[model samples]
Target: MTAPEDAIRARRRLTNKLIAGREAQRLRPFFAADARLIPGGGGLILGADAIVDAFAQQFHAPGFVAYVRTPETVEVDAAGETAAETGRWTGNGQSGAYMAAWRKAAGQWIIESELFVTLA
Candidate 1:
């Protein structure tokens, strides 16, 4: 098994690939059941289903561009059950810095929450 940080990086990569492919439905497994997200455009999304729905909407939007998140750092807690990922994201003609909280459940890493702030 990979280290927690590597696992999270892999997941983030997969997330970018899924978004690029417009496979929003397949993103469900990457998030926790009750995950939350604060979008770059300024709205709070609650629950994994709602988050996935939001992605679906964005993916189908006119002139949509796939978002890519490149992690700059990942830090796992001493307990090894949780991690924090800080990264930069770009898509839809916007670029931003983002942070995601990840939790390890049943030996799998899942995103618990994410916050995005548009920098430019």
Candidate 2:
């Protein structure tokens, strides 16, 4: 698949899982074991389990809804084995910006690292 196409698919996969409140399951299939998550105002969380646990906290928030903006610009590496996604998202009455790095694992794109910033 072309880089653009791959980016689209990766983004969709992420958003779908998030919307369905499947952060834990989502990581099982789409995150490296050593994945890292850095959320605004929070210390770094390493490992897929830790990352999922962190997101699960947000998932349980009352009336929390995740929204990943459409047409997110994803940049693909020349080898097509890695990509990066950056965009804005809103949930639980808070909006933020995020960037995630994805690496192909066993023929599927999986998140390797992520950095998020809350923008009020």
Candidate 3:
């Protein structure tokens, strides 16, 4: 495999590992990522810790543990540093677009950004 292909593979593995690990622990601290970022849950700060905390909060909601689902289709950028995915996540029959951004840090892939919206 080419270097880009290898990077894509590594990114996918990290993504899957993070998601599945969160599922296993029933915790995703950085998934939501906003309120907790601000000093007093006040404004937009977009900190890593806050994002993970948001995800964890989602898991804590009623029936939430069993609700969050990730079914994926992945595409990678030529630089091997960026990628995009489209997936279906269902709860209350409310499906929506899931967008994610990733970055290479300390020789590993990490989620730098993401958004989840609930559709009618």
Candidate 4:
């Protein structure tokens, strides 16, 4: 598959892992060391470690099931080195939108930044 297609599939798998609460398997392998996260309501979280820690806390919330709905799409830059996945996600009785930016290196795509905005 093309890099962009790979990125799109990877994001879906990551979302499934998140929904299943498989943090160790889902995050460490897919997030860059300097990745940043902007989870809704929470300001900015910088660094992969910090983001992981914050998510660990979030996973404790009851009924937390992170998932993306249909109509999601990924856009790859002309250079093919960067891509963005935008879609709607729902979990913990709340639905929202998410945009995850990814960077490709050594034929692998890893999340470089992510932003989650709650709409409901």
Candidate 5:
């Protein structure tokens, strides 16, 4: 449909799969540059390979299993084929928010960037 819708859907799919311990199936939609690890991290991952590597690491991490994104707070911002999203993430007796930048490409929403910091 639209960038906003696509982004939200992608987010849902990604989180759902992860929460289910199914990261393999969740790898398809993420773009190469989507591997920034942390939004605005300044570590600049330039392509899909980098993105996959970064995300795969997180997906395989010990504490990563405890992380879950609460679906109720998902929001997408659509502007010029790009959408930014913020969602609630909780687990391990801790919680925070994640910000992701998405770009519409090839009729699909692909994450372009992402970052997370603790919530107050």
Candidate 6:
């Protein structure tokens, strides 16, 4: 893996840890200001603040279980400033595939967008 790939993977691991710990507020740094997310159930969430808010709600929901994403592939663009990660995610008895787009800004890798699809 290249440096950008390694960095993205590390960020993703930290993100999983934050979610597991239910520390939604700490997730802000992992995403870009205008980040977007599409949940496994198929709804669009815009902006880092909104995304974090959605996560906070899920974390506090009854019977909620934290999601963990295991990357199957990380492809970095030629410019090394962007990457796409495809992975499998599981939580709350649900499992699915997810894709995340990452961007490097100010020497840090952050998520720009993500889309998830529940398969089972």
- Clash counts per candidate, in order, are 0, 0, 7, 0, 6, 0
Candidate 6 differs from the real structure by a C-alpha RMSD in angstroms, to one decimal, of 1.4
Summarize candidate 6's per-residue lDDT along 34-85 as a digit string, tens digits. Answer: 9999999998999999999999999999999999999999999999999999
Which sequence of candidate numbers ranks them by lDDT, best first? Answer: 1, 6, 4, 2, 5, 3
Q: Any residue pairs clashing in model 5, and if so which? A: 32-47, 32-48, 35-51, 38-115, 39-114, 39-115
Most TM-score-accurate candidate: 1
Report how far residue 12 has shifted in candidate 4, in Å.
Answer: 2.9
* Candidate 5 residue runs with Cα over 4 Å from true position: 1-3, 39-47, 58-64, 71-80
Q: For candidate 4, write residues 1-118 as lDDT tens digits.
A: 5667665666567656664664643666578899998887769999988877876777777765655543278888999888878888776677788888888878788889888888
Q: Write the per-residue lDDT of candidate 3 for residues 20-50, one digit (tens) a residue.
A: 4455333233233322222212344476565
lDDT of each: 0.96, 0.71, 0.50, 0.75, 0.60, 0.95
lDDT of 4 at 88: 83
Using TM-score as the yardstick, the better of models 2 and 3 is: 2
Output the better candidate (1/4) by TM-score. 1
lDDT of 4 at 81: 87
Candidate 3 lDDT (Cα, whole model)? 0.50
Per-residue alpha-carbon lDDT of model 5 for 15-72, expressed as tens digits? 5566457464466456534345563234555566765565676667776644666544
Top-down TM-score ranking: 1, 6, 4, 2, 5, 3
**Number of the candidate with higher lDDT, 3 or 6:** 6
> Candidate 1 at residue 106, lDDT?
93
| lDDT accuracy of residue 34 in candidate 2 | 94
For candidate 3, the per-residue lDDT at 77 reads: 73
What are the TM-scores, per candidate, against the unseen true structure? Answer: 0.98, 0.78, 0.55, 0.82, 0.63, 0.96
Best by lDDT: 1
